[model samples]
Every structure is written in structure tokens, then in C-alpha cells.
Target chain A: MVERTEKRHTEKMKKKQAAHDKIMAGKTAEKGLLIVHTGKGKGKTTAALGMVVRAIGHGKKVGVVQFVKGAMATGEKAVFDAFPGNIEFKPMGEGFTWDTQDRARDIAVARGAWDEVKRMIEDPSYDMVLADELNIVLRYDYLPLEEVLPVLTGRAPMKHVIVTGRNAPEALVAEADLVTEMTLVKHPFREQGVKAQPGIEY
Target chain B: MVERTEKRHTEKMKKKQAAHDKIMAGKTAEKGLLIVHTGKGKGKTTAALGMVVRAIGHGKKVGVVQFVKGAMATGEKAVFDAFPGNIEFKPMGEGFTWDTQDRARDIAVARGAWDEVKRMIEDPSYDMVLADELNIVLRYDYLPLEEVLPVLTGRAPMKHVIVTGRNAPEALVAEADLVTEMTLVKHPFREQGVKAQPGIEY
Candidate 1:
């Protein structure tokens, strides 16, 4: 019985290895990518920050532009600020939609943030650029797709870009190399009556 | 026309502020939580690491146990290693399931990792504990639910715990204070024929 079980496991392992090797063999080409994190769940921006940390660990510089969360300083921002030479953080948003009810002003601020992104993209010093909540503005049509899409797709050949928010534009999704939708399965605020905490949420 | 727009914006801001204040009034309770990141997306573990970075920034000690990723040194591990006194990382997995075909051995290793987790939970020194990929082992029944759920629910009242992986158990989900399901809208490996890159995917 033991011998039969061992033989079956060996055969299974060999088959799985062959499949993985075949798929990995065709995946050798490398280039900078456009990644999107969207949907009605948490962790979109948090995941982008994770990439920033990874890039910094590799001795690469990172740039972050917060499009709609500039009113308050967050825990993540504090940590990012600590890495002075490695991280460049520009919090440009005035506030949330309800707090800033002027659509025209929101559009103007979005343009300003995009200008910063364009500058960072052209600078070879920044290995990765994170456009935090750029999707929210894009979804609200605060920025023109004709302008945003071209600059993103035409970025330096080896500079990675990450755009994060809830509702990414269809054009951006089509042009992205990777897109993840964070589905809202369960939320503490809704079910367990828990509010966001300092270190974990921010 | 500009004056009218300004007046409308001011009134809207007032209403929004009132609503925010009312919500904030009821959110006075603060406590530790169990946050679960699950589903078929790419950011489960990455999101948890973001919190780790935040906790370390606040001078909070953290304990991380990688359940199924012990074979190699990752970029994140290097970053965690940099914070010698603040972060403790243990990569306890032998490898992925296919790499290790022995179910009995996998169970034993998982038990060993859980022993470390219990110790971390009871110890007051660590502010947060991240059980990376614990859900995968639980999904495979390597660790029984009855044995796992109690420790998770009975942890230190002030110590935060995060469990990340795909296919979280129903019992675990029910017990968790926050749960996020990362849905795979698009993947570079499947859609763009791109392989995982060094600083991004690792």
C-alpha cells in the first residue's frame, strides 16, 4: 500500500513539473508594465505600496502621487517619508469628493498630479511610479483618457507604473499588462462594527 | 456664475462634514482584529506586507511566518531582515505542494509553524503577527479547523493577526473581523504573456 502511494505521488509530481516548465519556458520576454488595482474592496493602494517597498529593497527609487487622499497624513506616508532619498511622495489631493464638491477644482488638481507623474516618468531616476487613486479621478472623468492613456503607455521602456482605485477606466484596463479587482467579501465596518485602525488600515 | 458655484460648494461641504462627524462619533471603540486576505488574486500576501511596513514605522514589533515559501530568499524578506530588532521573519515551508508531494510531511511542517504562531500570539512583545499563506494549508486540511480557529479567536485582545491566502475556510472567514477577496480580473501570465519580474512579483 505504501509503495503504491509513493509511486502515485512521484508520477503526479513529474507531470506537474513538466507543465510548469513548459509554461515558464515561453515567458522570457521582459519589459516595464502597467498594473491596475481596482474594485470595491480594500488593499489596492496597500498592494501598490508593497511594490514600492520591494523596489526600494532592490536599491531602486520610487515616486508616489496621491490623487485623492492629501488632506490627512497617513501611517504609510509617514513610513515612506522616512526613506528620504529612496522615496518621493507628493500628496496633491484636496480631499474626498464629498469634502471637495467642486468638480472643476477636482479636475484641475487631477491635471496637476498628472503633470507630476509625467515628470517622474521621464526621469530615469525613478524605477517605479505609483499613481495612488488615479482611477477614482479617471472614473469621474476628471482627466482626459486621450492624454492619460498616451503618457502611461509611452512611459520610459523600463519604468513600472501602478494605478490604484476602485473603478479603473475600460481603456486603461485594456492597455494594462495586469489588472486585479478586489472583491468585497466581508468588511468589519459592515459586519463586526469595527472601524479602521491606525497601523493596519493606513 | 462663479459666486453661485462657490456657494453651492460651501453648502455641500457643510453637509458632508456633519455626516462625517456623526459617523466618527459612534466609532470610538478600538481593539485588535483578525484580518483575512483571500481569493484568486495576486495581492493577498503583498497587502499584508504593507501593514507590516506600517507597524514597523510606528516602532511596533512584528512576527511573520511564511507557511509555504521556505525554499528561497525573497526581496521582501531582505527588507524585513534590514529591520533587525523590529521584525522577526521565519520562512518555514519546505516548498509549494507540488514541490513537496508528501502530505504527512506537509502536515508536520504546518504544525511546527503553528507552534511558532501560538508563541507569537501569547508573547506581548509582538504587536502584529502575519501568518503568510496559512490559508493554503488550511484549505488542504493540513491543519484542522477546530485546532486553528480557537487560537486565532483567543489571541491576545490587543494583538493584531493577519492570515493571507486563497480559499479561506468558512469557519475562519466567519471568525475574522475583516476579510478581503482578491478577484483576478486580468493576469499578465494569462493575458499579456508576461512572466513575474524580480522587484514586482517577488
Candidate 2:
């Protein structure tokens, strides 16, 4: 019985490998990607930061601009600070929209953050740029989508850009090369009364 | 007109802040979390690695075991190796299930990996334990869910554990404190003929 099962598994794997190889053979293009992480769940920024870490590991330069989470200190900020040569970490926002309470001020902050993002994209020295929470700013119309879309679309071919937030615009999703929406299944903050702790939330 | 807008914004923000403070005040519980990142999209393992970086930044010890992605050298392995004191990174898998093509071997490898995970969970010096892609093994019945769920649920109260993969068992999800499902919205590999690159996909 075991020998029969082994034979069946080997035959199935042989067929699967052939299929996988054929698909992979056609995937020959290598270039920078526009990755979007969206949805009402968490890990949008966390995943983007993971990419930043990967870029750093590969000895590539990275630029990070936090659009709506710069009001207070965060664990990522402290971690990114350690790699001064590899990353230019900028948390330019005053706070979340509701926390800031001023539309005009929010727009101004977004504009400033967007400028930093543009600088990183246009500069060839940086290999990856993370526009953290840019979607939230776009959702609130703090930064004009018209202005944002063109710059992102026209970025250097070899440069990677990651935009992350909840409620990403339809146009951005359509243009992205890879997009993942994080869906919240169960949250302890709501169901178990657990507070956000360091090294996990931040 | 601008002054009126500013005044209204201030009033709205005041009410929002009061509500936020009240909600935050009630959240006083502090303990370890069983975080599960599962779905068909990308970033499940990436986000878990991000938390590993965060833990390293905070001077906390971390244990990471990659169940099914150790056949080749990955960029993350090279990076995590730099932090010898903070992280114990282990990639125990021979490869993906189809690539291995032997159910008995897969089960044996999974058992070995699970032993490492359990060791980390039982070790008090480790602040966080990441069972990277553990759900895939559970999904395939390579590791018994009955044996897995209890150890995860009965872990030390102060030790955070993160399990990530697609198709998480419902029991694990139910026991988890935080669960995020990564849904594939658009993939470049399917749509744009792009292959996964080192810094982004690894």
C-alpha cells in the first residue's frame, strides 16, 4: 500500500512540476513593481516595512515616507533609524485625519510627504520607495489623485514603489502590478479587549 | 469661510478625541498574542518577518522556523543571520509539498519543524515565536491539528506567537487573537508576465 501510494505521489508531482516549469518559463520579465496593500485589515504598513527590510538586506537603498502616522514615535521608526546609510525614513504626517482635525493642514502635510516621495522616486540612488498610507491621503482627497497617478506611473523602470493603506482608490488598483487586500478576520482589540503592544502593532 | 471651517473641524475633532480616549482607556490588557496571517494573497510571511524585525529592534529575542521554504537560500535568511543574538532563524523544510512529492517525508519534515516551534514556545527567553507557513503543513495533514492547537493556545501568556500561511484551520483561527487574510486583488505574474524578484518577493 505504501509503495502504491508513493508511486501515485511521484506521478502526480512529475505532472505538477512540468506544469509549474512551463508557467515559470513564460515569466521572464524582470523589472520594478508597483505593489499595493489595501483593505480594512492590518499589516499594510507592516508588510511594506518588510519589503524595506528585504531591500536593506539586499544592500539596496530605500526611502520610506509615512503619510498618516508621524505624530508619535513608532517601533519601525526606531528600527529604521539604525540603518541610516541604507534607508531614509521620514514620518512627515502630523497624525491621522480625525486626530489632526484640519483638512487644509492635512492637505499641506500630504503635499509635503508627497514631495518627499517624488524626490525618492526621481532619484536613481534609491532602489525602493515606500509611500506608507498614501492611499488614506488619496482617499481623503488630501492629495489630488490626478497628480499622484502620473508620477507613480512614470517612475523609473528599475525602481520599486509600494503604496499601502486601507480603501485604495480604484484607479490605483487598476494600475498596480501587484495588489493584496488584507482582510480582518478576528481582532483582539475589539473582541478580547487587548491593547496594541510594542513589537507587534508598531 | 476658512475660519468657520476651522472651528467646525476643531469641534468635530474634540468629540472624536474624547471617544477615542474612552475606547483606549478601557483597553488595559497586556499579554502575548496568537497572530495568524492567512489567505491566498501575498505578504503573510512578509508581515510576520516584519514583526520579527520589530522584536529585534526592541532588544527582544525571537525564534523563527520556516516550514516549507528552505530548499534554496532566501534573502531573508541572509538578513536575519546578521542578528545572531536576537533571532534564532531556522528553515527546516526540504521544499514545497509538490516538489517533495513524498507524503511520508513531508510529514517527517513537518514533525521535525514543529518540534523546533514547540521548543521556542516553551523557552522563556524567547519573546516572540514565528511559525512561518505552519498553516500549510496543517492544511496538508502533515502535522496533526489536534496536537498543534493546544500547544499554541496553552503557550506562555507573555510569549507572542505568529502563524502564517494560506487556508488556516478554523480551530486555529478561532483560537487566534489577531487574524488577517491577504486577498489577491491583482498579480503581475498572472497579468503582466512578471516574475518574482529578490527584494520584493523573497
In order, what lDDT does every prediction score? 0.84, 0.89
Worst 10 residues of 2 chain B by lDDT: B71-80
lDDT of 1 by residue, B49-119 (tens): 88888888777899999899884356676566666788888888988876777777878999999999889
Q: Is the docking of candidate 2 incorrect, acceptable, medium or high quality?
A: medium
Q: Best candidate, TM-score-wise?
A: 2
lDDT for A181 in candidate 1 is: 91
Per prediction, the TM-score for chain B is 0.93, 0.95
DockQ of each: 0.57, 0.69
Which pairs in model 2 have colliding backbones? none
Candidate 1 C-alpha lDDT tens digits along A16-90: 877887888888777898999999998998888888888877767999999987743466655666567888988
Q: Second chain of candidate 1: TM-score?
A: 0.93
Lowest summed lDDT over 10 consecutive residues: which window, candidate 2 chain A? A71-80
TM-score of each: 0.92, 0.96
